[model samples]
Target: MTTSADPREAARTRLSAHREAVLALSHSLHAEPELAFEEHKSAKKIADLMEGAGFAVARGVCDLPTAFTATHGSGDLVIGITAEYDALPGIGHACGHNVNGAAAVAAALALAPVADDLGITVKLLGTPAEEYGGGKVYMLERGAFDDVTAAMMVHAAPVDGLGFTSHAISSWQVAYTGVTAHAAAMPHKGVNAADAMMIAQVAIGAYRQQMIPGGIVHGVVTCGGEAPNVIPGRVTADYDCRAETAEDLAALKARIRACFEAGALATGAELELADVGRDYADLRQDAEFGEAYRRSAEALGRSFDLVPSGMRGGSTDMGNISHVMPTIHPSIGYDCGETIMHNPEFTAYGTTPGADKAVLDGGLAMAWTAIELATAEATRTRLLTAHAERGGRAAGAAAAR
Candidate 1:
């Protein structure tokens, strides 16, 4: 006797089978936290799991040591799922990337066995350095997403639902060079680099009032005077500027650069500016993919709280991918209410039972969404049309700019 094909029933069964392995992976990554661009152990652990599950694993992809891709099945519908494992500086696993890595892996595994039956090709891509470096941007440049039809990932948040809009972002480093001399005796002979940086910061602060409503400007002084008594020969700072769209971010960056130049001119210091990380484009959510994910999550008993207009905000490199292809970065709630991400308290709750529930729920929901997009003819047409139209509009807009 043959059984009727029920995707939901199959998904539940598959997820149940791999529950222990997924939880173990999450726990292990949490216990041994690694910093950005240095997730060797975590990467290897995930690769091993994928390889064991019959995926064709490609290690060290995109020239990144901690980056890899695992593919299963060869089908017309190609869907990509991303995993992040890099932790924050001084606060290991604070963002719960361990959960993200494990959940992505579990989702891929659950769908692997039925990929061919569902006429879908599943790819679980391990992207490193998300805490600081824009790993996905690099991978995109290196052609990791060249053939992908769609991509999806889930994020841990304080509340459940589709996450808020993210700002387009640019990361840059600024340095000032001047002559060093004794502060009290030869202050006139020495050009203070720290003074130049201070002036630049002041300029930025003053410029804030003139910026658009959603704009953000923040930075940290990485290097100041070595000692109070000595005039600093060199000073450096890192800054991140954000706006609602890529064009807006580009404009704001130009203005910010002028502020840095102003500091150099006033203090007679030489200024050097370098982009430290990837340029994150503003998020463009695909309506088809977003609705599919919403429906899948709802089917799993998940409810969404649409982010109120003008209230959603953050910065993410995933925005870059969304700009190019159909993508979604839905939030999976863990109810560590009022304890926002990147805090020590949130880190404590990252591995709790609630957090684990988010892992399963998010993974299964994303998997189901992919399945729907791949198998349902109507949904596939919508996805393709949206992608083509968005691509054309984006190209035209870029040409106009």
Candidate 2:
């Protein structure tokens, strides 16, 4: 750490200097929304901005066209700030990823000038498909995060929050196939795939009574039938199962699978359960990281007054990254009336003045958090040790394999 007086002040000044560009970036993302791994334009915007700011930019990282890594400084202590830019299908920026991504960009720019002085590396990861593809999980598995010592990101929400952990979730493409016949003439001669789906839904409803606490099952029937006059030959749906932990989610999936199998047994239909993407693990927030973030956010006049409602947060790929490193996933709040996240109505506020302020504050606070992590003795040592231990484990696993 530098001997300068409160280096956070320097980072704050740099953050303010980047204010116009960051807000413009946020509004641009909100204006032009892209989805999942197809976020080519979004990725370019972030990567270009980071490169212009003197960070080394790598595109198409981890074999994902939309994923990239931008780094400043070559210090031993590496702080990773993840930026998400993918939008929801059909709905644009409803989750305020524009705010989230821009804030992360702001943090990286703010920390760049001080990174060398602080003896820390600032890594800005352009993580895509957070809404559906689990890009962070892919990056974590493929070495995008191997050199990162600690990771952090701010989520867009209706209000500020902290220490709110997310659920472990898995999604599946469910299908049932059977023989088809005319409904009016020979309905009794045909095996009904739609009927099988109905049976499975009923079984699921009944099982809900005995379902494990904190379990969530929800999905959409993408294809139910062809016509009312014809007996359906096939039925397809997309469903997600979530639990408090990865192990519990597996158990929940087993029971859910049985219900689907029961549907097939009753109707003699073929059933298929194909996974959609990588499963997201439950988040494990590091205590010291969370505390340091709280102090930083508090100093910025952002209050964490939202009490815990006991409801588990929605799934995020960052949860998988947090399981491996010291990480903090905080909520950078703004006023959006009574609307909730993922609601299209909430999208309207992503470019508002309050949301702009959130961009600056969230980014500056994160930069400050990084400063504290580098300067504070205990957290600095702990994060460094954890990084070394992770490397050792990776080396040992490779040797054994």
Candidate 3:
């Protein structure tokens, strides 16, 4: 019943003991890539692993079938470790969520043994559908993260970064309906849906010049028509609008919707805009936690290029978590040899030796950072005070009731 003299050393030792299983989890996730809310197998594997490690595992915590939570220890300062398991559509694991998920699991396992000693609670969240569907957003709205004092997750990338800003985004699935007629036989009788889509695209492109700084509007036509001989009765497109903040994003979406409406009016076609998942807010990283992660990562030979403020990366549901509590989403680097994220080549390297090393390093660094957060009195008090003010404990109690 003897504990190690240093908790950080003890955590690292525990992580080393579970190294093989951690690497296996990463490889297994890479081999079986699941997309968005369809991460059943991925969620089960992670939950099973956490359960085996003596955590109280809960599945479908926030009404999201693929989402889960695993808890260890009963300390007042709760730390959330997020594991994102969803992959990109066709490319699979292109964003390296396998590495991301495995690293988070590793961090939680590493900290679990020393959690009580450090006066902290470790909560591993099986957060799904980061690629398209905003699983974290849904979970946050449902109070999944309300109890946590702070949260952290490492994302896989070509280079290490302390953290970077992310855009606020809103996406929609738009469709235009019109009369169908044979192209040559009844040209006048047909109101072309394809023409309406084309006009919308043109209007959007023209509007881009007047768009606010850092605001972006982009989309793809999923369905234009079936045959050139027949006028398309329906055309569907997926659109995304993003800006620096929620207010800017709201304005941007309004302008983009106007373009869609104009297309429908000009072609006498009916327009429909279906909401696509939840809106994502801009990321706000906790500076102290970010520095701790950077120090721990650098100790393990990872160099981070601290991105300038206001420079935005892509949107993430994790951004929603940041708004609720102190959060850090740093990028863990691997040697992908010029392969950027979301590419087929990058997906191929997700479970390579470099990626395996990333899983270990990222996990170990996060564990060390969590230990620092617990041990530092000022930092711990600040996080706890903020958590209380936000009604973190009250929300947890309400949810339990």
Candidate 4:
């Protein structure tokens, strides 16, 4: 850390210099949306920017074609800032990943000039498929985060929020198979897979009354039937289960599976469940990191009003990363005039002036937080010690194996 009046002020100035580039990146991503695990163009655009910024770039990271890592400076304290650019299937940037990715880029660019002086390495991770594929979870397993001391990213929402946690989740692809027959001629001769799905949905609805507090189960029937005159031979659906913790998520999944099994038993349909993606863990926010971020954001004129009671947060793969290291996932506000996330109206606001401001503010705040962490002896020591411990554990596990 340099002996300067304020590293944060320096970070803000650097971010201001890169303001146009960052906002341009955000708008470009918004114009072209890509889905999970399939973000080739989005990944390329971001990687290109990182390369242009003089970072050592590595594409196709962790066996994920859409994943990449860009590094600047060589220092003991490595700070990772994740950039998520994947869009929803139809809503396209409704969740403001364009803003998220741009903010990460802004932070990385701002820190690049001062990284060496601060004795910190900046790692900008292009994490894809956060919406459906749990890219971070996959990267975590594949050791993309092995050398990262701490990680953070900002999310875009209707209003600014901090210290809010999300549910752990598991998603599945479900199917039921049965014989098909003509409805009018031999309806009694065939088992109805569609009816099986209906039964399962009803059972799930009824089970909700007995479900544990904070548990959620929701799904969509992608394929129910082809024609009304013929008995449906197969039915397929996608479902998501969420709970307050990993253990609770497992228990909730068991109960939901039972309901599906009961539907199969009663309808004489063959049932199958394929796990769609990795199980996301509940977020564990680091107190020091959260406080540092709160101060940084507050300095930028962002207010922290108490979130309304019972206002729940959605699940995120970032939660998995938080469990392994010190991390913060805060929300930056943008005016959308009563529009909530995942809505088309929300998408409209993603590239607006307010959203652009969010990009700069979030990026600068995160970079400022990084500056604080790097300069503070106690926090730096704690993070460095944790990184060493993680390395030791990995080495021990590998040697035992």
Candidate 5:
């Protein structure tokens, strides 16, 4: 007697077959965490896995060594699954990018066998430098997402559900230059760049009160004077400005720049401001896609705690992609409640059993959602309508402004 193969069952079987390999990949990345723009080892490991799994892998797709793409299948409905593996500056894998990378890989691998039947094409994109360099933004600019219908990724967080909204963000670096002088002797002849930075900080502090609710302005003085005995000639700082929307973020950034300029004008120091990364636009999640993901995840025993509007927020480069195409960035839980992301404690959880489970569950759910969107005409129509509606609203708002 011949057994009939069920697509979903077969996909699950494929995932189980590669379970050990996927977990091993996550462990390796967690053990050897590399900072943004420097994930050479992690990138190579992922590429090797994809190549071994029969994907045609291309490395350095956007001129970044750590960036790559692996594609399988030739169906009309192309789905992009993105993986991020870059670690934080001082803490490794703090944002659970190791798990993110492994899940995306597993999802693509599991869906590979059913792609032909479902009329789906799978593209696994290895996006590096998400923690600092905005790798997705660079990739987007280089036509990486040109042919993709939609993109999906999961983030590890305190809860497992959809993320409502992300704040629009911009990052910049400010450098102050002044003449150096001896502190004890000719202090009057020199302008203290550190003093200029202090002035800027004060200005920012005062400016914070005038900002609207949900607006955020934060910075760190990266460089200060060398010694206490000498007047410092140079100082540098990094500032991040955030707002509820991209337009609001732009206006806030302008005001913050004026504050930095005030520092230069008061202390007679030359001020140089450089944008550190691409502006992280506010995320506009596809409601239809999000609901589909929610249903898929719930079928696997996941719970979502819905929040009131305007209460949830973060910043991500994926927002930029959402503006152009349908996208979803959901949150997967790790049993670390009330624990903040980008923290050392959260990083430790990325390799734990709970995190491993999240990888499997999230990966399968996303893959199933992709299959549904590809094979079901109603789902595709709903997603298309949602995308068009969001685009029209955005256009109307721009025209009104």
Candidate 6:
């Protein structure tokens, strides 16, 4: 339903009006990088800014201290914009979460003044622990997205992309326990735990030839042994498995589990393969939502599919949201010469001029897309139908439960 005057133009004007503040937020987040579940200061920065912008901010939503929801308007048509602020372990802002967070803030601020006109609630969800923890997954389980009509967020990347798929991934903490004895004198009497790990690695390597086309397995042995002269009684390793989709990931994990079990069976060592975090489902960007975003971004002179990187995207928690509702997770690009993401080199470019432009462009583009979702009759009807259908499904599921 279009208002008397279109709100998209007003939203753009509002975004341009607050350009300085938005870039400052991005620089601040880059300067003070926080790790997963420990993004107190980072979360405070965004929440405070949103509160000042007339959003009703709720801190510590879903029992997660760093998670929050900042919202405006009371319309049933809810627009959710996710913000991630967690930095990598050693490389601060290497994944450009600073850009991601600030862009989301920009979108929220731009749309806030016009939320009522559009008959939509602009919700900025402060999601933390994207690097290591599945914060979005936790929020989903706890009902943070129960009323969301559609979700939108743009990831920071070296090249602009749309409709790209991210891998479904799972992390594991593997351990092996065995009897220790003198390595030189009574090697046969000792059940070697390191040998168990070695056998598992060998099995995995052997299985690669027959592994699924899109399956990926990678890990590191954290502890192999105490000393070479003594038989290892314990061994620990961290591992990850990725596939094209959630179903494929499940199948891949099953095969990988068998590989791990073979090590325990052959070496007579007890094995423990525990999950480190929630499994991330593969990204399934809504095509209609993505097209709207593409049009908005193109209006800002941003080009799509500019880079020719043939590789699939890495994992992200937002993929889980896409599985449930109409969602758009576009990659907002900036110029980073030869420095790939997650590297220390990439962090230095996060607050650069190019990245700043990305913050503004991406933010305004998302705002415009939201306007399109609200005013365009066909698109609005499609999304509204999805929202209603999703509600019915939820009701049915609740009844069964």
Pairs that collide, model 1: none
- C-alpha lDDT of residue 56 in model 5: 91
| lDDT-better candidate, 3 vs 6 | 6
Model 5 clash number: 0
Ranking by lDDT: 6, 2, 4, 3, 5, 1
Tens-place lDDT digits, model 3, residues 1-401: 12357887888999999999999999999999999999999999999999999999999888989999999999999999999999988899999999999999999999988999888899999998887879998988888887889999999988888768899999899999999999999978999999999999999999989999999888888999999999999999988999998889999988999999999999999999998889999999988888888888888888865455446799998998898799999989888987799889999899889999999999999999998898888899999999888895566767999
Mark the 10 consecutive residues where model 3 has the least summed lDDT.
303-312
Q: Report clashes for each candidate as comma-separated counts.
A: 0, 0, 0, 0, 0, 0
Off by over 4 Å in 3: 1-4, 306-310, 392-401
Error of model 6, residue 396, in angstroms: 0.6
Off by over 4 Å in 1: 1-4, 309-311, 384-401
Per-residue lDDT for 152-258 in model 4, tens only?
A: 99999988888888899999999999989999999998899999999999999999999999999999999998999999999999999999998999999999999
lDDT of each: 0.84, 0.92, 0.91, 0.92, 0.86, 0.93
Please provide TM-scores, in order, for all candidate models, with all chains considered together. 0.93, 0.97, 0.96, 0.97, 0.93, 0.96
Better of 4 and 5 by TM-score: 4
Can you write out model 2's per-residue Cα lDDT over 179-209, one digit (the tens) per residue?
A: 9999999999888999899999999999999
- State candidate 1's TM-score: 0.93
The TM-score obtained by model 5 is: 0.93
lDDT of 1 at 203: 95
Q: Candidate 5 residues 1-401, lDDT tens each?
A: 11245666777889999999999999999999998888999999999999999999999999989999999999766789999999887888888888889999989999999887777789999998877768999998887876677899998777776847799889898899998999998999999999899998899899888986779998888999899978899999888998988999988988889999999999999999998768988988888788888888898898887543334567888888888788998988877655778888788788889999988998998887887787678777655565566557666977999
Cα deviation in Å at residue 89, candidate 2? 1.8
Winner on lDDT (3 vs 5): 3
How far residue 398's Cα lies from its native spot in candidate 2, in Å, is 1.6
Q: How many clashes would you count in candidate 1?
A: 0
